[model samples]
Target: MKSVHMDVHALLDAGVIERRAAGFILPYDAVHVDFFLKAG
Candidate 1:
């Protein structure tokens, strides 16, 4: 779980996610999300 959190933080650092008051959000659009998923 710590590693997962670290990865999320890394994503935040990379501007791949937006950290909100309550949670985080993947800022990519759905098409990019799909591409990212497949690319990953």
Candidate 2:
């Protein structure tokens, strides 16, 4: 689970996603991976 958190942090740093109170939320839908990746 630590690795997953690391990856999520990387994604947020890359501007691929944003962190929220609920969890990670994708800002755009241009990429296919974001749709399948759930923020928890």
Candidate 3:
């Protein structure tokens, strides 16, 4: 889960994805991530 977060964060830092397009949540000891990308 940590690795996933790191990957997403890297994309955000690199401007590959918008801030609103990436996020994560933990529910019931689980990691949940949701990302939205603009369509061409």
Candidate 4:
């Protein structure tokens, strides 16, 4: 999970990519992630 967190942090830190929203979705008893991003 730490690696994933770091990757997301890197994206958030980038200037060109905007992080609009992010969340987790639970389906089939598993965790799925959703990220909304926009390009500058």
**Candidate models: Cα lDDT each:** 0.81, 0.85, 0.64, 0.57
Instruction: State the lDDT of candidate 4 residue by residue for 1-40, as single tens digits.
Output: 9998887677557532445447532223553568899999
Put down candidate 1 lDDT per residue, 1-40, tens digits, no spaces.
Answer: 9999999989889898899888998766752534334553
Query: What are the root-mean-square deviations of the candidates from the true structure over C-alphas?
Result: 4.7, 8.0, 11.0, 11.9
Model 1: residues with Cα > 4 Å off, grouped in runs = 31-40
Q: How many steric clashes between backbone atoms does each model show?
A: 0, 0, 0, 0
Worst 10 residues of 3 by lDDT: 20-29
Query: Where is model 4 poorest over a 10-residue stretch in terms of lDDT?
Result: 23-32
Better of 3 and 4 by TM-score: 3
Better of 2 and 3 by TM-score: 2
User: How well does candidate 1 match the true structure in TM-score terms?
Assistant: 0.61
Candidate 3, backbone clash total? 0
lDDT, candidate 1, at 14: 84
lDDT score, candidate 2: 0.85
Q: Model 2, 1-40: lDDT tens per residue?
A: 9999899989888998998899779888678653456689
lDDT score, candidate 1? 0.81
18 Cα displacement, candidate 2 (Å): 0.6
